[model samples]
Target: MAVHRTVEPSTSELGTFTRQNANTIHGHALACLVAADRYAHIEHEIKPSLHAGDTVICDRYLASTLVLQRLDGVPLEFLLDLNADILMPDLAVILTASPGLIAHRIAERGIRHRFHLDPTMPGREVDLYAETALTLTAKNVKVLVLDSSNATPSELAAEIADTLPDPR
Candidate 1:
């Protein structure tokens, strides 16, 4: 099994686009860049690994777009349409925690992106992720929602691993 992320190898053109300040780019434009990166990621990394009989675990996928892009003022339908041709995950795991806990963790870790500047974003993200879970489920993607508020990292990994089908 291998773990992959949407924007990888930060030096790549698409990865650079993802690192740009949100204020410098239009929301719709960023969404397009992200979708393009996803396609590139699938073709360059995910599909090849899967063909070799490897399980690829993506850190973020369509669900992230459904939530973050929507936060940037893009409509759901536009996002859905933009991402309509992307590869869908077999299992979409959504790890969540209480808004307060999430906020506290972010504070401790310091802000990484423009979204973290808004204090209300934490609560909004929690709500959006819950909604995203249902949306993914409706698309026939197996959705697993885990609360990370109280569990340790190891515990959460074990729980997620338990839900995976045996590769045998």
Candidate 2:
């Protein structure tokens, strides 16, 4: 199994820029940077791993872009166009939780990004993710909406694994 990320390698210029400037960058520019990083990630990591017969699990992908960039005031159509050529996942698992639970978790972890600064962000993100799930489904992507409000991470992983088609 090979686990890839949208901003890959961690040391690449694109990844560094996206991470370091995420809070300060404008939405449109950030979206473009993220799209570029994704394409690079696919070429460098995801494709190679898949060709080697590894199961590539991406931590975040187009679904996340659709939600997060939209939260940054970028339009949905713009985001869709930005990410139009990316590799679609066979299974896009969207984990959701109640707003209260989400807020509590964010509070416990401390804020990592500008989005976490808003009091209403947790609710908005949950709602957006729900909407994103439907959008992905309409695009013919297999989506698994899991409620993580009460389940342990191990339990969630088990459920996700079970959802995968058997190899044999």
Candidate 3:
């Protein structure tokens, strides 16, 4: 199995643009396009590994794009159209926690970037993720949502591992 992470590419360049133009419709759309291009590049690079039977586990993929873009006011239909051809994950694990808990964790670990710059972002993100999960499920994608409030990391990992399909 391969663990691939979808990090925000061209952050310095695109991030500067995003920071300056936060909440602008066109700006947000441009950022989404940049992210799509990055995902495409990563998919091309890992084609061989996938062909050789590795189960790629991407940390964040299309789901994130959906949620973030929606939060930026992009219509869900538009987001779905944008990602029509992107590969879908076999299992999408959405880790959720109460906004208070998430805020606490961020306070302890520190904010990574401007995405969490707003003190209320955790709550908004949590709500959007829940909606995203429902939408993805409606579209027939298998999803597993785990509440992170009470579970330890090890416990969550064990549950996810157990949920994987049995190897033949």
List ranges where model 1 is wrong by over 4 Å. Answer: 1-11
lDDT of 1 at 16: 70
Per-prediction TM-score, please? 0.91, 0.92, 0.79
In the range 51-138, model 3's lDDT, one tens digit per residue, is 7666556566667767777666678787787777766667788999999999999999997756667887899999999998998898
Better of 1 and 3 by lDDT: 1
Q: List the residue pairs that clash in candidate 3.
A: none
Using lDDT as the measure, the top candidate is: 2
**lDDT of the candidates, in the order given:** 0.83, 0.85, 0.70
Candidate 2 lDDT over 64-168, as tens digits, reads: 888999999999999998888888888899999999999999999999999999999999999999999999999999999999999999999999999975442
lDDT of model 3 at residue 122? 90
State how far residue 15 of model 3 sits from its true place (Å): 12
- RMSD (Cα, Å) of model 2: 2.0
Candidate 3 residue 45 Cα shift, in angstroms, is 3.3
lDDT of 2 at 113: 94
Give one digit per residue, the lDDT tens place, for model 1 in 20-90: 64556658988887888778888887888778777778777899889988889899899999988878988
Best by TM-score: 2
Any residue pairs clashing in model 1, and if so which? none
Scored against the true structure, residue 139 in model 1 reaches a CA lDDT of 91
